[model samples]
Target: MNPTSPFDAERALSLARETLTIEADALLALRGQIDGAFVQAMQAMLDTRHRVIVMGMGKSGHVGRKIAATLASTGTPAFFVHPGEASHGDLGMVTPGDVVIAISNSGESDELNAILPPMRRLGITLVAMTGRPDSSLARHADFVLNTAVQKEACPLNLAPTASTIAQMAMGDALAVALLDARGFREHDFARSHPGGALGRKLLMHVRDLMRGGEQVPRVPADASFSATMREMTSKGLGATAVVDGDKVLGIFTDGDLRRMIETGADLRAMKAHQVMHPHPKLVRDDALAVEAADLMEQHRITSVLVVDAAGHLVGALNTNDLLRAKVI
Candidate 1:
């Protein structure tokens, strides 16, 4: 009985790397199997008027839930239904127009197979994702998308590693195909993920987070520098817009005042327009808030003017406002 050498860390890492390589190769092989049936599955889902109801058991169930979420977020309305629950009266959730995607490695999950008959009776289209094309679920399916893997990454070939990855990748393929078919745009995706950073970046318009009406720190271009300073202080935005009618002529910021004073420019003798930085960076009302943030960062400015299509100063926003809105 020779004792194992003090838990060889390097050997453990080597084995882990080998497992990852095997899984990666398996996925690459799976990609080659996509064919007409894959297209048919996507077409079936797109043609269905009701939501996609994903069903599976055990590890497949977990993967199915994630697939359902990805589909919903990408513009296909979908949800997961436990097949075991469907056997126990949850089958009522399935409707005639819905498409059912059943996931199982062997395509013979008893609980999942149990709900298929009723789903078919209700006129629901069945799309089976399985490793075995000859299995019961695949035999009954209107379309079968293969997720077969030659072997698991596990040494004993028992774990669901390579098979689960294939299933998830196939699910993604279905989602992306549906997304393209529906012409799902970035704005649509942003609407679904409004609480995420990407949503804030793409969906939020400058006008949505800008300070307008009386809250805007603005002064006439010809007003005294003292008045501009007073406006900045009263508004608490650290800057003031110098406007002439509806047009923005310049901006007077704390930095601008500092430079003006250092240049021996007398505030008492100068008008706001004379000392203000002219033609400051401006953004359109419809511009994405993230783009506004990028412009401000590029110019090293703390604030920006929100203008309408005709270049009229409609609103203003500072760094603090962007931060508050979580657009940064």
Candidate 2:
């Protein structure tokens, strides 16, 4: 924000390192605080049939939102409800069976405390995440997962730097523990993140994005170079497979075409098999698209032949298909 300030790499690096060391110490200290209260909180979250309603104020609220998202994506049903918003008609989001994770570094957020009595009356289980175990919020909570930090990374020791980092790390610990307890797998994670590249890599098979049937460029091994070029051009995939009945004899790519021309091979007299790569890269239709992409990268090829266990060409695909699917 200060345009007049000078930029110094060494000073910036020193400050950044100090900040990291402070936060890292805070996180390390959390390991010792993971006692019976932490286990009890995890159990309550796991046993909740409804959902985990996370509540916090200010910086704690920011950490709580990310915590809730981590829980939700990692197989726990969770959502963040701003403590300030909870009093203003957002209390309806909490139900009788739901579990509440109330977070406060001071354990005295007025808005969060304001809704606790009614929440208790509604018979909802309350778990507190606070730095002050003796504070009012802890006294009202059924279980308290203390997130106490020695001090903030801020030079003033007043900002929520180290404390917020500790809180987020604690939330991640809960998610990872619940993930293991619930038998969550990679496929389950992929299902939750279907729009992401990781999901595409984990879930998409070759058949899911391959060009099959007529869209595949194919020509007979005995076909002339002109016919092969026509097939490649029509498909616009930069490659074509030379087949003998259902079997793949060879492959001819645009690269192969260039080599043929450079060598001055008489195109009118040459056959498809004459200049084609005898052993073209092949992948199974059931193989993962990520595997296909790896194969292409390893072989330095633009396309691959998709076949079955019988070694019959069923389809084909180029890098563009993988790119469009976000698999590469």
Candidate 3:
């Protein structure tokens, strides 16, 4: 590497601040540029029977890919197609009943413009996203989304820094607008992103993380205190449910054992029901795991019994179970 002069920290910080200010101002200006054309474009996309096709060149293409992804994940079917590739044979992907959003800063890209006429002939709805309203792309478009910026954030005023931010903002605006129009909910978004954190919170149920069958610590209501303590110790849940058949009658925990010992109670003479706490906090089996976490947090308890609609003790879960499931 070649040697360079000493770096000026103040100058670097000043430039970073100026770059952010320029981009912030550009977005502020773009906010006022929202008009009927944006609404028309959104309506076209919403009414399309097929997918929304996004096309762009250079930096705008990167923004186009993100726009398509956001739209697809938020209930609108969309994808990105490179303009240069469309000129070869990718243009065949454009069919009738689709909405095309072509993005360009100057709105005069040769590769993008070359395929515009053919896309028009195919009778697809064309929406032009550009800074120049009078460019070739806008002329052929059915609707125009103006993403004009006062100047580039680059020191030379050449690179697409502020312009790219404006494009991204516009794309997000459209995706959110369509999301609202479709009445899309969190579950819908989770369905598309099943591998994400939101999916685990929304899709996973208490039964999925609860200890069922033999894993549950339980004993009969008529069992001796020692047997109940043995059941609790063997299951390692620090607690045991006192059940009458499948019905949950009460619960006994290590805390109860300590309290009974402190009170000088006759421990060897106590039955399971005599020592257990009745009406313990319970969670439904089909409840969301996050809901179980909420129940534990709200009650300030470490564990809860899982029951069915008929109030039968089906399983049990503790803070450790929720922690292992990453629901806490």
2 or 3, greater by TM-score: 3
Which consecutive 10 residues in model 3 have the weakest lDDT in total?
A: 1-10
TM-score of each: 0.90, 0.85, 0.95
Pairing residues by index, what is the TM-score of model 1? 0.90
TM-score computed on alpha carbons, candidate 3: 0.95
All candidates' lDDT scores? Answer: 0.90, 0.92, 0.94
Task: Report the number of the highest-TM-score candidate.
Answer: 3
Global Cα RMSD, each model? 2.7, 3.4, 1.7
Global local distance difference test of model 1: 0.90
Clashes in model 2: which pairs? none
Candidates by lDDT, descending order: 3, 2, 1
Write the residue-wise lDDT of candidate 1 on 1-105 in tens digits: 459758888989998998899889988998888889999889988888898999999999999999999999999999999999999889999999899999999
Whole-model alpha-carbon lDDT for candidate 2: 0.92
Writing each residue's lDDT as its tens digit, candidate 2 over 21-94 gives 99999999999999998888889888888999999999999999999999999999999998787788899899
